[model samples]
Target: MSESITVAGVSVDTRHWIGGRRVASAGTFTDHSPIDGSAVGEIARGGPDEAEAAVGAARDAFPGWAATPRAERARILHAVADGVEKRTEELAIVETTDNGALLRSHRRGVMPRVAHNFRFFADWLLRLDHEDFETRGHTNHVSWDPAGPCVLITPWNAPLMLATWKVAPALAAGNTVVLKPAEWSPLTASLLADIAAEAGLPAGVLNVVQGYGSEIGDALTSHPDVRRISFTGSVPTARRIAASAAANLTPLSLELGGKSPLLVFADADLDLAVDLAVEQYDNAGQVCLAATRLLVEEPVVEEFTRRFTEKASALRQGDPRDEGTDIGPTIHPRQLEKIDGFVQRALAAGARAVIGGHRKDGQYYAPTLLTDVAQDSEIVQEEVFGPVLTLQTFTGEDEAVRLADDTRFGLAATVATGDRERAERVTARLVAGTVWVNCFFVRDLQAPFGGSRQSGVGREGGTWSFDFYCDLKNTVTAPEGWDQDHG
Candidate 1:
C-alpha cells in the first residue's frame, strides 16, 4: 500500500484499485480544492488499458462471486456498511474536500445514507426468497442471477453516497463490478475501495478506476466483458454512454440530470413551502433534484418570494469544513463559470435578481433567487445545477401543472398544499419519476428513484436497483407427457 498523503486537510490515496490490489496508473493528474485554488492531491489517471484490466478482473471473479452463498454475500455487505459507519467522519471530510459539498450535510445526511444503503440492500437481498410456481404438470422456477461483469460510473455531486447506491446493490446481486469515479471527485471513491477491502470482499470483485470521463469512461462502458452499465450524470453524457453501450447492446440504467420543479400553491402552508424552497440552496444547489424551477400560485407569489428569498440570502457561504456554513463553493472553476453564465443569461433576458446575482473568488457562487424569468428562458428550461432559483407564477392548478411539466426534463418534482386531495392531484399531474408532496428530497431507501423523458431512463434504490443489477431467469420442467399436452 502506498503511504497516505495529506492534501487540503485530508488524507488520500492516489492509486487505483485493480484486481483487488492498489495499482499505480501510467499517468497522474492534480486535484484542486474547490474551497480554494490550492492543490488537493495527485490522482493516478487510468485510461482504456485500465478499464480493460478492471473489466477482465471482474469477469474473472464473476463465477465464484455469483456462486457464493447469499448469506455470505449479505454478511460481507453488512461488514462494508459497518466499515463505512466507523469511518463516517473521515469519509465526510474527504467528500467535502473533494466535492465542495458542505461537510455538515455530508456527515449528517450523505454519510449515514451511504451506510444505510449498503445495510438496506444487504438485508433486503437476504430476505428475497426465490420461488417455483406450480402449474398443471409443470413447475416454473424463477430466480435472480448476477448480470455478469458490470460497470458503474458515478457523478461528482455526491461521490461516496451515490457510489454506494450502485455498488452495494450490484455486489449484493452477485455481480462483479468495475466502478469509474468521476475525475472531478475521486477521493471518497478511492477511500470506498479500501473500506470494501477491509470488509473482506473477494479479490477482483470490485475495482475502482480513476481518470477523466473523456479518458476512461467510454472504454469502461463499451468493454466487451461488461454486461450492464449504471451511470448517474448529466443528460448529454448519459446520451453518450447510452450510445457507446449500444456496441454490445449492454443493458443500461441511467439516473441523469434534473430540472426539478417545486410548486407552492396558495392553499399550502406558507412556512413549509418557504422551507422547501430554501432547501434548494443546499449543496450550493448542485443537487440533481434541487428545486431549480420554483412555481408559485399567483395569490401567494409575493409572500412566497419574500420568505424564500430572505432565507436564501441569509444562507452562510464559506469553506465546507466550517460547521456553520450552509453553502460551499462549487466543485471546480468550470462549474462556477457555468453557473455564473446561467445567472448572467437570465439577467440579460429580463429576469430580476432578488437576492444574489454574482460570483466570488475560488469557485464561490452565491445562492441566488430570480423572478420575472420567462418560462422558456435558459435558466428556467435548463438544469442550472447551481444555487440559482428562478420564480414563476400560475393563476390556477391546471396552469401550475402545465408550467411545472413544461420542461423536457422530469427527474423530480414537489407540490405543497394544505388540501391533501389537491396535493395528490397536482403531484400526479406533474410528469416526474419522484414527486414530493409537502416535502422535498426526502428519500425512502425502498422507494424507486430516477427521472423521466430527458431526465433519465430508469430507477435506482431498493428493489428497482436489484432489478437493474440482476437478471431474472426462469426455468420450467414438464412432467412425463406434460409437454405434449401443453403443445
Candidate 2:
C-alpha cells in the first residue's frame, strides 16, 4: 500500500513505483523540505532487492512494448503529457518544496518544460526516418531498434525535468526504463509513475526504485540484463557508475558536472549582460549550465560589475511557495556548508566578494559574486555548483575564448556580444556542447546537447537522444526475384 506524503501542502503517493504499482522497501526514510527542514514525506528506502525487482519487471515488459506500434507508444506518451499538464500546479509546488527551487519558476517554466519533453519526443517518434539504399543489385535498409531495459539515474537539481529528458526518449523508442531518481528529491518521481499508470502505460513499462546511489547504483547498472544507463550527476559518481557498467559492457550516457563561463565583451549591451549575470542565480545557483565564471572584457568590467551587483542584491530570497520570492534555500544543510566553504576558501586566497559572500539566513546563501580571482585558482577552475559567480578580466576575443575553454568541464557557455561576426568566431573557439551568443538558455529539441570532455559522455536531444537509447541496424536484402526454391 502507498502512503500519502505532503510537501508544501501538496500530497502525493511517495512509495516506490515498481512493476506498475506502489511498493514499499524493507526500510523508510523521512524526506525533509529545505525551507525549514520539516519532514515532508516518509518514502520507501529501496535496496539491492528493489533494484533487482524493478529490472526484472522491465525485462519482462520489454518485448511486448517493443512490438507495439510507434503510433500507439506516441499516444500513451501524449496521455501522460496530458496527465502531467493537468497536475502542473500540484507537481510544481511539490517539486519546489522537494527540490528547494522557486515555486513560481517551477509553476511557469520548469513544469511546462517537463510536459513539453514528453510531447516533443512523442511526436518526434512518429517522424523517425528509415533509410533504403540500393547498391550492387542489393537493397540495404537501415532502421533503429530499441535497446532493452534502460537504467536512468537522474540528478536532484531538476529531478523530474531531467528524468523525463531521458525517460521520454527511451520509452518512445519502445525500451522499458528503470528510473532511479536521486535520494535528495524523489517525491515528484513517485508522482510521475502514478501519472504514467493513469495514462494507461503498460505495467512494467516504467518502474522506479527509491534508494541512495551507494545502495542501488551498482545493483542497477551492473545487472547483466541492463542494456543502457543514462546518468546526470557528479564526476566522482559518474566514475563509479561507469566502472560498474563496464563489467556488463552496458552503454552509458553521462551528463556530469559543469563549470561554464559567460563572456561579456565591450560591444555587448551592458544592461543585458548584467541581467543575464543575475539570472545565473536562478534555482539558487544549482543549475549545472549556469555561467558560474564571468569572463569580462577589460574595457567595460567596472560598469558591468556594478549593474550586476545592484540587480542581484535586490533578488528576493524567501519561502519558495511565495510568488515574490526569486530563490529558496539550498536543498540541504550540508549543501549550504559546501557552498560557503567554496566562497570562504576563495576569499581567503584573495578573491574579492563584490556584494554577498556569506549565509543570509537559515540554509540561505546569498547571491554571491567574486572578483580578483586568478585564472588557475580553485574557485575558477572547479564546479562550485552554487549561486556563486567569479569575475576575471581579459583583453580581447582570443583571451576571452581561452578563459572560457580553460576548464575541463564544458557543458555549456554564453557569449554576450553585439557583433554578429564576433559571436560566431568566439563561440566556435569555446569548447562547449551548447553556446548562446546573446541569449542564455534557448533550448531547441533537435539540437545536439552534451559536453566536449568530462562534462558528459553522450549527447541528448532529438536524433542524438534516439541514437543513444536505440541501436542502429542495417539489413541487406538479396537482389529482387532471387529465390532459393527456384534455384
Candidate 3:
C-alpha cells in the first residue's frame, strides 16, 4: 500500500515519518519553487510536540538497531544505496524542483553521490577496526558504540546529499535518527524518507520532521533523548543550536558556511584557474564551500579577471529543469535580494562590476563578477552565497596567504599553481579544512571533510564521521581473567 498524499494542488507528501510510517503533522506550511514562485507543495509544519514524538520514536528504536549485527547493518545500508541508485532520476527531479539546483547537476553530480555516500559507509562498516592496547598485566580493549537517539539537521541547499552525509554514517554506526529538513526545501527530504523506508529500514529507526527552523529547530536540538547532533547551515543558526545543545550537554558537529578563497599565482595554469572561477556560478553559487574570493597574483590579475568575467557573462540562467541551464534561480526571493544587496553595497564601496550586477528575471539573478573589491569590505569578509564573485590581487606568496586567511571563515580553499612546491607551500599555510591543489571541488569520500574557525566545529567524512557519531569506550581486564578460552 502506498502512503502517497497530496496538499495544496501539489502532488507531494506533507507528513512526518515516525515509527516507520508517514505520521500526520499538527499543522502544515506551503513551499514554493524558486524558479517561478509557484507553490511546489505543503510540508508538515513539525514543532516541539512533533519533535518530541519523533525523538521518542528514535529513542525506542535505538537499542534494537544498535544490537543488530554489523553485517546486518551493512546489508541494510547497501540496500539503501541500491534504492537511491534505482530512483536517481526521480530524486534528481524532486531536488531540482524543491531546491532550484540544475537538473543536470543533480542527476549527474549530486544524486549519484547521494547513493555513493551510503555505499561508502556500508563498505566502511566492514573495514572498521577498534582501538586495542596492551598493559603490563592487563589488556585494554576500546570500541566505538552507537550514541543514543540523534538529530540531523540539513540545510536547504543539497538537502538530500547533505542528509545522506550524516544519515549514512550515523546508521552505519548504529544510531537511530530524527532528521529535521529545512522548511524552505523539505520535499526531497520527504521523498528520502520514503526511499529509506522502502529500503527496509526498521520502524522508528529513521524519522523526518519538516518545518521552519524557528519553530522546531530548538525542539529537535534540545530534546532530552537526543544524544548527538550534526548540523549544516549559517553561523548564526549554528550558534543558536550550540546553545540549545549545551543545555543538555549533548555532543554536536556543525558544518557552517565559508567565505572560501581561490588563489592563482602568476606561474599558475590560467586555463584551469578560469575554469574553477566560473564554477563559482554553479548551483547559482549557493554553496558553503564555493570559492567566492578570487585572490590572483598582480601580474596575471588582469588576464584572469577578463577571462573569468567573460565566462561568468556566458553562463545562462533559466528554468533549473532545463538540461542546458548553466545557472538557475536561487533558493528564494529573499536570497536573490540578499545577493543583489551584497553587490550593491560593494559597488557603493568602490567595487566595480565587470558583468551582471542585477537580477535577470523572477527569482533569477544574473551571474555577477566584481573587481577592485576592498579586502575589508563586507563582500569579501561575508559569504555572498550567490552567483557573485569578487576579485582581489596579491603581490607575492606572503600577501596571497595573508589575503586568503583574512576572513573569520576557514572552510575550504583552492590553490592553482604549476609548481608542486608552490602548491605545497601555499596550501600548508592556508587556514582551511580542505584545500584543493590545481583542482576545485574534487571530493573524496574517504578524506576528512569540514572546516576550521567559524566555518565549523567538527569533521564529517570517513573515520571522522564514525568517531563523531559513536562514543568510544575502553575496557581493561587483568591477564588472569583473560585466560578463559586462551591456549
Winner by lDDT: 2
Report the Cα RMSD per candidate. 2.8, 1.6, 2.3
- How many clashing residue pairs, candidate 2? 0
Give the per-residue lDDT of model 1 (tens digit) for 345-435: 8899898999989997678997888988888888899888888988889898999999999999999899999999888788878899989
Relative to the unseen true structure, what is the C-alpha lDDT of residue 377 in candidate 1, on a scale of 0 to 100? 85
Higher-lDDT candidate of 1 and 2: 2
User: In candidate 3, what residue range of length 10 has the lowest lDDT sum?
Assistant: 1-10
Judge candidate 3 against the unseen true structure and give its global Cα lDDT, from 0 to 1.
Answer: 0.88
Q: Supply candidate 1's per-residue lDDT for 202.
A: 96
TM-score of 3: 0.96
Candidate 3, residues 1-487: lDDT per residue as tens digits? Answer: 1234442233556788988888776578878888789886556787888889899999999999999999999999889889889988888877788889998998898999999999999899888887677899678997889998999999998999999999999999999999998888887777778888888899999999888888888999988889999999999999999999998999999999899999999998898999998987888999999999999999998899888777767777899888888988999888988999999999998988888888887998888888888889999999988989888899989999999999999999999899999888989999999999888888998999999999999897888888899998889887774556778
Candidate 2: C-alpha RMSD to true structure equals 1.6
- The reply for model 3, stretches above 4 Å from the true place, is 1-11, 482-487
Residue clash pairs of candidate 3? none
Clashes of each: 0, 0, 0
Model 2 clash pairs are none
